[model samples]
Target chain A: MKNYLENINKAFESRARLGIMSVLMVEEKVDFNTLKDTLQLTDGNLASHLRALEEAEYLRVEKQFVGRKPQTTYYASPAGREAFKSHLDALEQLILNNRQKD
Target chain B: MKNYLENINKAFESRARLGIMSVLMVEEKVDFNTLKDTLQLTDGNLASHLRALEEAEYLRVEKQFVGRKPQTTYYASPAGREAFKSHLDALEQLILNNRQKD
Candidate 1:
């Protein structure tokens, strides 16, 4: 069965992943160490999540050398923005639907 | 490692559960049918998620007889409110932290 809710992107169901998407949604792109420090995530955990999003093709990765040091940057792909938008729209709809009860 | 982010409740990470909380957070209380209609959730799916929150003690349920029929209403308990607040704070912090890059 194809559930409409399933399209909301379970990949971002995790707070960490959702946070990463939220960050990328606004910023043009963000680098690794900044994402780590900003999100207060451990190297392993952050990298793991980055890989997950990367594999999902929801994120665009740019590998560059900054002063002879490897620096990786992340961006939300077009599909990623669409998925996140749908996810947020689902949330907003939920909130909107319940407003009469509020 | 006891990461501070772990303190954020994972229970409401799902959109459905978070929607439930967001509804209860504002409404004094909501009944089963209302929640179902508002969330557009199936009976089994809604019941399971409700059970998950109930088990977490984040939700308060009041059962009574309305016209000889059983009626169940849900409320967000104080602890549930606190946990949800912390979760939202974490989200806000993530957005806040990334503003510099945005």
Candidate 2:
């Protein structure tokens, strides 16, 4: 019997991190303010989750200037996208497998 | 914006507990030994995860004897089923929302 649970990644366990990845998965790039607003997270709280994902090498960050203001943006790296897809696939499997029994 | 991430329960964050719930959701009653084998979890590991779910009122346990051996069986509480369904729905929403953008 295959253990589908093994495919659930701990890195994406937190809702905050999950939200970040969910947004990044679809959008090519999301700025700090946009992400913070979308997820409705405090600066500190969002920053911490972003740092955790970055440390896991699941996301890449970019800093640049928009006009006179400094802006930070995030992107889902190839590795991150691959891992997130696998995690999603595992969740789908868990749900589908149970549904079949019902 | 309705944050689908908000529907993701912290209780199901651990893969072990998730596996336990996934199994319990479908099966009416599962013995401790059967759960341990299905999830490929050690006794201590499975016990701890079971305790966590029990604490959350997500699962119910019944203990009795069959022949000369003591047997423990588990069932997913109504709350557990509801919570797990919400989590699965949130994951499905996340995946579907992103897919539409592709």
Candidate 3:
């Protein structure tokens, strides 16, 4: 129970943050537009959330010109990946514990 | 990636609801007051959330007398347990997929 609560709680510390982290957890890197579309978020909204993730050092943002247009791409940093892994492990332990109770 | 997004999204369909589910994912049965304390929720707030979970058939509530006072305890239903397990699996697959990318 302790393990379950700790993991789910950690994984859900921030709702939007978790969504972004979950997406980055799988994709090597995704463009800002792609993230915005996948999440159905407004430009400003996505940018703000991305900024928060960047500040947390959970993600890295790369900005450059893509065919003369400014493009930004995001990727999960090592720390971010580790945090996501720990969070998932906690959730798994919780499920296993529950099954044992049955 | 598809698996990770699906699991995290389902696990977090509702913030407060997820919290309740996560707690019940372990412990066999928990009393209302105990749940309240663990979640730091008000009586009314807890009751409302409990009612929602009850309606979802995700939990079973038993009302009985403990000594002289009425005691209400909650446990996850079989279906609820299955749902939680599926959710955890999704999260795990997501983590594994991410690790494979490294």
Candidate 4:
């Protein structure tokens, strides 16, 4: 049987943004440097993408002081979580369809 | 509860490519012109993307003659279907997480 692909299509929005979402999806909150290292993204590039997601309200950012330096952490919002789940379901169906074909 | 976001992140791959996958997910088979119109993509642009997808083995193209003209139909291959499904699953989780926040 053929699987539906709407969520798969949505997956094509932006690679960096997607990565950020993935990282944020698992951890309750992640530090900026850790995210950068994990995703191997340059500071500017990561900041730009994070700004976009923040603007879309998919993520929330918190800034604070850690010792003498500044720290920024990110977390996924509830809406973002729901969107991801639905997208996952659609993707799973697509995979199932392909497996059946094989 | 906090939701995961890997699938949501995967949704940012490519808008047009995602759209193509979305349409194919529901339809058993789709024609080139129909896909072009549905996506509102230029002939060359659509053809280029289709070529990439076909190359990736995500889609299959069948060319035939309809009446006196040529017709091309496309379908998602098994691998392509699986990839698309996994991608969708990631995206759905992202959305779900966001929704819960509200």
Please give the ranking of all candidate structures by DockQ, highest first, separated by commas: 2, 3, 4, 1
lDDT of each: 0.78, 0.87, 0.72, 0.71
Better of 2 and 4 by DockQ: 2
- Per-candidate RMSD, Å: 5.6, 2.2, 4.0, 6.0
For candidate 2, give the lDDT of residue A65. Answer: 91
True contacts preserved, each candidate? 0.17, 0.57, 0.30, 0.23
Q: TM-score for every candidate vs. truth?
A: 0.65, 0.88, 0.69, 0.61
* Top of the candidates by TM-score: 2
Error of model 3, residue B39, in angstroms: 6.3
User: Once superposed on the true structure, which residue ranges of model 3 sit more than 4 Å away at CA?
Assistant: A7-19, A22-28, A36-51, B7-28, B36-52
Q: Interface RMSD (Å) of model 1?
A: 6.5
What digit string (tens of lDDT, one per residue) describes model 1 on residues B1-88? Answer: 1243465578988868877887788888999999898778899999999999999999989999999999999999999888877776
In model 3, state the lDDT of residue A26: 74
**Candidate ordering by lDDT (highest first):** 2, 1, 3, 4
Docking class of 2: medium
Which residue runs does candidate 4 get wrong by more than 4 Å?
Answer: A1-3, A8-13, B1-12, B15-30, B34-45, B54-67, B72-102
The lDDT, on a scale of 0 to 1, for candidate 1 is 0.78
- Which pairs, if any, clash in model 3? none
Return the clash pairs for model 2, or none.
Answer: none
Estimate, for each residue in B1-102, the C-alpha lDDT of model 2 and write its tens digit: 247777878888877887998889889999999999899999999999999999999999999999999999999999989988888888788777766766
